[model samples]
Target: MALIHCPSCAKRISDKAPFCPHCQFARTDDPESLERAARIRQIKHNQSLMTHSFIALFAFVGGFALWWWGGEAADGWRAPAGIGLMSAGFVGYLITRVRIVLAKRSKG
Candidate 1:
């Protein structure tokens, strides 16, 4: 219910607005909430990446270990499976990157 200055454009506007009505700046008040939301989204996105990357890393490790230990499985098979894990990790990374870009655009 009080007036606030917009961080982006330095205009006076209502504090309740998530973005400044005048110049579309972020409201100074409750910036922590916004930051927190951003962080939460980032963590979730990164966690997803971690999951995918871990799967890939583990697959690679398992394949390497088996090969190193002289396992009977074909080298080509293990290589392809490792490649699959890396592809999954790459997909996850791309997803998170898109999400971050979208979020930044939305804030504008």
Candidate 2:
């Protein structure tokens, strides 16, 4: 069988194959299918970004709140706990930002 390129992923596949082995793109030559595949990928990427963003937001807010509440405590443990929470939140946010930048670079 002759090999053909899978438009969805630009991978080579046997012309007789029912679907692309790598990306699972169907063998159809329809333009809409390719567009649909791209759209699906984009939607998934957006969902991931949203999830990260929410997590980052929650972490930052929670950490700040903890720190604020802990500052009012007479015991020393609360201050340390608050600092740890804030540090964790900062780290999480940094990681998320890095991932976002990397993703954008890869996409470009």
Could you tell me every candidate's TM-score relative to the true structure? 0.37, 0.60
lDDT of 1 at 44: 65
TM-score for candidate 2: 0.60
What does the lDDT read for residue 5 in candidate 2?
76
Per lDDT, the best of the predicted structures is 2
Candidate 1 lDDT tens digits, 6-93: 5554457786777767655454447785576556655666576567656655655655554445655446665566556556655655
Q: Which regions in candidate 2 have their CA more than 4 angstroms from the true location? A: 1-27, 70-77
Write model 2 residue lDDT over 69-89, tens digit each, in one string: 745643466667767777777
Report the error of model 1 at residue 69, Å. Answer: 5.5
- At residue 48, give the lDDT of candidate 2: 90
Candidate 2 clashing pairs, residues 3+ apart or interchain:
none
Report every candidate's CA lDDT.
0.60, 0.75
Q: Would you list the clashing residue pairs of candidate 1? A: none
Quote the lDDT for 60 in model 2: 72
Worst 10 residues of 2 by lDDT: 70-79
